[model samples]
Target: MPYTRPARPPPEEASLQGSELAHEIVDVLVDRQAEDVVLLDMTSLSVFADYFVIATVDNPRQARAVVDAVEAHVLADGRSRPKVEGAADSSWILVDLGEGIFVHVFTEDSRAFYNLEGLWNRAQEVVRVQ
Candidate 1:
């Protein structure tokens, strides 16, 4: 599937409202040794999503694992399952959690090419997980 940028949230709204769930998702990524976990504040950028979580996994297997972790975390927390994309190929998996969008398990080359951080330059860097 092509890369579709999600809708941005309102500027005045607080993206961190889902901080607890975000932390849980970040924890899962970190535990799996995902790289460069970045939280992008998309409040002023667009009106669709609040935050964007980006990270990289080493390989296909790890990609799937990361997706599983995110799915498990959100479901366990009583939140709905994110609208997942790109899981079959395990190259770039995007978990759309409504208020937040999580991009997991990308290869180094893919991550570098997409450069989500650079693309959303206007977004404030909320946190960086190792």
Candidate 2:
């Protein structure tokens, strides 16, 4: 079967209200075979995005694929194109999906080095996909 994008949200609706986009991102990452996906609720702890979705990939190639897939999904949802950081060769890539949602894609070694979950330990753990 041919792949298809999800329907765009209504034009009248201003934007994603809360953690709706974060949850959608969790599904996207999982679909692409991301491992140990963790969704953190940063609403009360941080002034940045309301939530953060972090996942680990196997390699740089997989990292690039995951980032591109996420970009496509976010654009298809009618949200502004995200501001992406880091190169495909980098160990970590950060995607800033506007409206207080940030995504961190990391390789196993990099994930361990950065320790985002520990740094943001105060944030609530919304979901964990093992």
Candidate 3:
């Protein structure tokens, strides 16, 4: 229950007991209407985080909805509020759910431009929600 960061994929999603939090985040992203929601398992690939929940948003409003929904769900589940990176209008946003869980939210163009999936191509793709 104390923050223990996962050691692989992720940017700003919680690490509440590791994979459990990552999966929980995936659910939240889907519930909020995120597109191309992907849960990347970086346990064997990265060093900074354990899991990455990358999602695509349509606009700033959709981005806010995704981030807000993630925060609300995590808090309601008894974890502290996660740290969020980027402005409300940012093309890309990161939610740091401390301890190695990261959530990356980006606009379609931004998602394509950054190409995290391409960068971490070696990381195992765990759960992908449409």
Instruction: Give the top-scoring candidate (lDDT).
Output: 2
lDDT of model 1, residue 61 = 78
> lDDT for model 3, on a 0 to 1 scale?
0.88
Q: For model 3, where is the 10-residue window of minimal lDDT?
A: 8-17
lDDT of each: 0.75, 0.89, 0.88
The TM-score leader among the candidates is 2
Q: Which whole-number lDDT from 0 to 100 does residue 28 have in model 3?
A: 86
Q: TM-score winner between 1 and 2, please give it.
A: 2
Model 1 worst lDDT run, 10 consecutive residues: 8-17
Better of 2 and 3 by lDDT: 2
Report how far residue 15 has shifted in candidate 1, in Å.
4.2
Where is model 2 poorest over a 10-residue stretch in terms of lDDT? 9-18
For candidate 2, the per-residue lDDT at 106 reads 97
Point out where model 3 deviates above 4 Å.
Answer: 1-16
Better of 1 and 3 by lDDT: 3
Give the poorly placed runs of model 1, Cα more than 4 Å off.
1-16
Candidate 1 lDDT, 1-130, residue by residue in tens: 8999767556434344566566667778888789889877676787776677888878877888888888887788776777888856667878888655655558778888888888888998888987
Error of 1 at 6 (Å): 22
- Give residue 110's lDDT in candidate 2 (0 to 100): 98
